[model samples]
Target: MAVGEEQKRSPREQKMLLADSNGQNMTALFSPRFKSAAAMAGWDEEALLLASLVVEDTPDRDSKHKRRFVLHSKTPPTNSSRKRRSQRTPQPVAILDLDEEETPRKDSGRKKKGKKISEGSKVEEGGNELTEKNPGVSSSSSVLPCIDKLREELSCAICLEICYEPSTTPCGHSFCRKCLRSAADKCGKRCPKCRQLISNGRSCTVNTVLWNTIQLLFPQEIEARKAAGILNGRQQAQNLSPESAFYATLMNRSTPPSGEASGRISRRNVATTTSRTQEDEDAALARRLQREIDEQSPGTTTRSRVHNARMRARGGISTSQHEDAALALRLQREEFMQTYRGSQEHVSSRLPSSTLARANLRSMASRAMNLRISDRRR
Candidate 1:
């Protein structure tokens, strides 16, 4: 095949060829992911297979390309209509442009050539009006109700996500295929979105137009999810119950650790049984006993006694070292106080009272001696 032809081959064709070569039958072609075994109606074999690939694998389509490729039915547009509009400016739709519904002519079991009026009728007419207030019955009521009923039936049970090839469980509830498969995986093939028994084995397919409508309404969301991953619930248990998960993560971030650590996990920790094994307790006991023996062993002992020595050393030297440290600390503090003493304090300690009293006595004695000498000379 030419490179271009090879590149354009649909995934369905590739899968089909692989299955046939491997000696598998038609039933193998259709799976939880692949919706149909038969080719798409109105499309050629190649087109049909391409579409299947698009649906099955490229769950997420390129957004830029979609503006040109996929047209959703929720939006009422046709290619011809778009082309027509493109040729001219688009015009607003007029309500008056709608045609009136035609009234049905009833046969009286015998053919009548002329119009006959009922006894209570106001005017001569071909048929009597069911209600005088209304001129004719309309197609709106019949057409609209069917559309509404379809919408209600197509909604998904889980995440209320739109049902794509929705599968119904024994409980009569429905979910998208990707959604249910995910639920099956996480909750052990049980419905995570709903507590339904998936193993009950009763299942059903989604209505096609309803499936198409979902594709239309949430094309981007579906495609993004498909391209990224199956949006179905393999949803972490936390996501299935968001309120609990959020508070738990928040609490975990804020929580302080126990003797476990300084900053503890506040969030609800979901440690697996295997992650915390029975052997852990035995290992812990072994470690504790080993440590006790090592601590009792002396520094004179070799490295075999290290664990016990280190642990026993915890309080063994703490007290003696602490007392010596405290004494050295007090002596250093007193030396600092003496070395840093200020001039004002030194002067105040040797202040006036005693010196002043002695100076006053010396002056009085000198005055008495001088006075005695002066009296003798006279």
Candidate 2:
């Protein structure tokens, strides 16, 4: 069958021929039966490929075209006829005068200003102090709800307290600098609030503008917190042991012993000293931890060296063991030599000096000499 004959076939017959074979003919050109059928029907690779796509698209395309055809056939004509208007009598137009005011009894601007002044005077002197609100002015103390809202905004999510040395994440969440550092180092570099990736930067800075605003708005709260922190710190310091106190003292002293002789340190000096002390203490702690780690995980060579040193100290495999071994070998060699000489003397005395006897004695001597040499070597 040629392509022209295939195209000439009725639509019903073509659908029947192209009906799906349970997806078995999906590789039409690969399968021998389908390939022969396609070749007989005058299809090339390009035509087969194009036909495959067409077959896959046919159902959707046919349904869409059918819908469009039905709509086009059934739809009413849009060329509507124009309607004609009937002639009617004209209505008279009335114009109102703009000379007179619409509201004749309205108060003048001067009267309004006078009334506002009178109201202000009444509030100042005649009105009850609490009830009347000053027209344009509001006291901060009265706006407690607004203050509370602002405090909430300033509070750190990690601590649930007002942010001290506040650090802002890329995700727009804010936390205290110390709290953020601890979380990033221990938990993860991802943000806790929004779980966005956070940069690992050395500097954990406070938002200065936010800090100043918070300080101004909540001065009392900030002062109270500072006082509480100081008290707690003093208590903890007092609780520390003598050893800890000694280290703390060493850390705190930034200058030489001679500098301590000068009396009356200022508050600024004390704060500076404490900050320096913290840095020193942190450095000392890191060094101590590193030392402990090195000691715990000593290298193979170091471990072997230590083991050998201990063995030497305990007299294990010493010079005395070596001396005892040498003495035992000397005694064994002497005993063997004495036994061999006795055997040789006995054999010589027992045998006569005749030709047969001499031969026998010679053989016995040779055997004894060989045995003695072997025993001495052992």
Candidate 3:
């Protein structure tokens, strides 16, 4: 169907079902179904920036659109930060009350002696503070990290490092799906703050901003972690932070290396234990895979359809168990030979006709020759 027709369809028609962790099935809404009731179709970044600037400057929605906004700032707006907390009162830019052509003549010496100075000082001190807000969107933190800035800085948003299976929320909040899921456990699948119900799991896209941030800030750290097979949970990452290390070193009178973190914490963060335990799990996985490979019948098994249909159609076909087994063995041997051939090539390139190379080459050539002889005999 065309994209337009697809859009008009019910979200239910496009929903996909998948098994959740509990082994029960559930429906997930997909993105692209969002209906924009207010904003124009083409919300270019330049437009958004301009809107942000307008919000920065004007700070107030016209009274007519008041109810439509989730939170509206009531104070006057400005292009700058207001008075510091230490100051007596906040000052906002006064409304431009002059005509466009007016130019007040400067009279420095005479005015320096007048009550006009006191009047001007009082007027400036009494100006109201400017507050900016998102219309129909509740303010969380007024000075939020900009989305572009986030994309530019972080390598990963959800993990707050490099992204892995990141899922965005409806309100544009994001977490690694697993991380978000973890955070959701502390609250729910919905965002902890917005509470917007994300219907489709797939449509929740990546937060390019957060991902970029991690890449910029910790490129080498990320590479080392990936190389060392390390995956950090939020807690572990938090504990490794500068503030935590600072306090720790100060309290101990010496900096403890991250490797020297408490054993209990390390054990809790990483699932691996002694090397012996890892070997045991490796053995178990090997056995499981072997059993799985064996459980599936060879292509020649009964009820399978590897037999040539065209030969049967031509009424020129006859088959036997010996022929089937020979074919299967030939294929399997070819696969084994191919694997050994790669290893042989690598060994040859790395060594000058080394003993290992000679042995592997001989073994592969012998298998190939035997297979060819067997095929000739057949």
lDDT of 2 at 203: 62
lDDT of 2: 0.51
Candidate 2 lDDT over 1-378, as tens digits, reads 797565445543533344434134456536788788878998786667667857765654565457558788466433421110011111110011222342332445456556655544443343234335664533332244455676678898888888877888877788888788888988888788888888863467888756655555555466677768755764576478543432343223322231321221332354557544544444444345333323322232575347445546768673454344335434533443344345446547753112232233344345445543543343
Where in model 3 is the C-alpha error above 4 Å?
1-165, 181-188, 192-195, 202-204, 208-213, 228-362, 365-369
Number of clashing residue pairs in every model?
Answer: 14, 0, 22
Highest-lDDT candidate = 2
lDDT of 3 by residue, 24-52 (tens): 21112212332231134655544544454
Per-model TM values vs. the true structure: 0.18, 0.27, 0.29
Best by TM-score: 3
Local accuracy by lDDT, each model = 0.41, 0.51, 0.41
Clashing residue pairs found in predicted model 2:
none
- Least accurate 10 contiguous residues by lDDT in model 2: 85-94
